[model samples]
Target chain A: MDNLKIEGTKQTPEIDFNSSTGILSISGRSIPENTFEFFNPVLLWLDEFSSIAPEKVIAKINLEYFNTSSSKYILEILKRLRIILKDGKDILVEWYYEEDDEEMMETGEDYEDVSGLPFEIISIDDE
Target chain B: MAKQSIYQSEIENLEESKNFLKKSDYSKLELQMEFKKLVENYEELIDQVKIITKISDRLQKKLNKTNIALEDSNIKLADLNDQLNETIDQLTEAKIGRKAATIVMIVAIALFIVSEAFIEPIIDNMFPNNFLVGLGLKLVVAILIKPGEDFTNKYMLKKARKEQLRESQLSHNNKP
Candidate 1:
């Protein structure tokens, strides 16, 4: 499948999906006008990727912030990753947040608890 | 969207009921049944709405933050570009200033040579007794030097101060 790459914008996140290397990265801020439209493709891509995932799938998510709808979509993403993990593929979710964001840290924790998947909450340096 | 509106209206009605519920006169069983049913439904809806709304709003907040962040990044990028342009302008100004100073110095030297070598002999021929005109002209140029340098220095300092204040104001406004 062709890699899915969307440029980051004021209202959306950057998506870098490499089919050859098998390292998927979602960075920048993600606050889209229509949550369903922005995330549906991501969901579809994950479904395709899971079918023929690499031996190891590292999904790096370095988001500055997101909306509630995006949060639900994030949960969906984690749930998909969990499925890939259950398929006996080595899966790791690298959740990057600003060091000073207490709410974001708590949010990551909440997702970790809910998803029951291995998550690495990495603190990023302020720009 | 209609359902969301309904939820808001329901919450509003509940609030209104809470206000008048104490004053209304009703039989014990009537009050118990009405209150219990309302409370039970309210509690359940609140729980469901709580989860839905929480997820909804958190995602909204995330999107809002991303927008603000993108704007901030753009502002920072603009500021850096302005600073770079200013630096380039300063460098160009300094280069032009150095060249102007050199040209002025050369002109002064040429004027000195003309006065001493060519004009002194002519002045001597014109006025045998008084040649103070040459001295007076030289003195006027000499007197203008310090004030001219001071004016240039003060003008540059004021311009720099204005730029600093502008940047500071921009930073203050951006803080939030």
Candidate 2:
């Protein structure tokens, strides 16, 4: 499968999913004008990746902020990851938040509970 | 057109299930499977709602706190700007006062020189017995000194304020 790469903007996050490495990363703000349009390709890519499932998959998510619709799409992405986990493949989700952002840390915990995926809630220094 | 939603696919799936129950002719086993699927979907939907609501509210609180901090910073910045402008005005007034004093002193010295060289001689030739006229002329110059300095100070301050206003407007216009 071809790797997926999307550039980050002021209103959107960067997406870099490498099929060869089984490493998926999303970072920056996500407040897209069209949530479905922004996420549909990502969902389709995950579905494709699931068929040719790799030995280990890692999803790194680091977001400063996201709107409500973007939040729903994030949940959808985690659900797809859960499917991959159920396929007997090793899966890990690394959720990064700034050190001072207590709310973001709690958000990662909430996602961990909701997704039921193995998550490493990591704190990063503020830039 | 209907507004696009992130939940559109989920909503469609639920509608499909509803329609299947209303119209599909299914065996008992098929019915049981469909019911299970429906329950699972419903459970997932509920979980999504619960988590999304919790996250949205938390982020909203964070946003509100940030806005309050931004407002406080803006107020402090405005206060500092006012203080700076007042200091500049005070400095400008002191500078203009000094300039006005210097100009008045120079004019007083020039008048003294002219009176001694030209006016005193003419006065002595016309009124040989009266020495009070020369002293009175010098006294008039001294009396006008305060009002002359006051006028110069007012003029220079007005000009300085006008220049400051013009520079500010130019800077505002030039800002990208």
lDDT of 2 by residue, A1-127 (tens): 8999999999999999999899999999999998888888888898889878789999999999998888898998998889889999999999999999988999999999999999999999988
Q: Which candidate number maximizes lDDT?
A: 2
For every candidate, what share of the true interface contacts is present? 0.20, 0.53
Shift of residue B61 alpha carbon in model 2, Å: 0.6
The runs of at least 3 residues in candidate 2 whose Cα sits more than 4 Å from the true structure, single-residue gaps closed, are B1-5
lDDT of 2 by residue, B15-45 (tens): 8788888974889988888899889888888
Q: Encode model 1's per-residue lDDT on B15-114: one tens digit a residue.
A: 7667758775878987787788688768756654555466566656755777899999999999999999799768756865665555556666777788
- What is the C-alpha local distance difference test score of each model? 0.75, 0.92
Global Cα lDDT for candidate 1: 0.75
How accurate locally is residue B67 in candidate 1, as Cα lDDT from 0 to 100?
85
Which candidate should be chosen as best, given DockQ against the real structure? 2
Q: Ten-residue segment with the worst summed lDDT in candidate 1 chain A?
A: A101-110
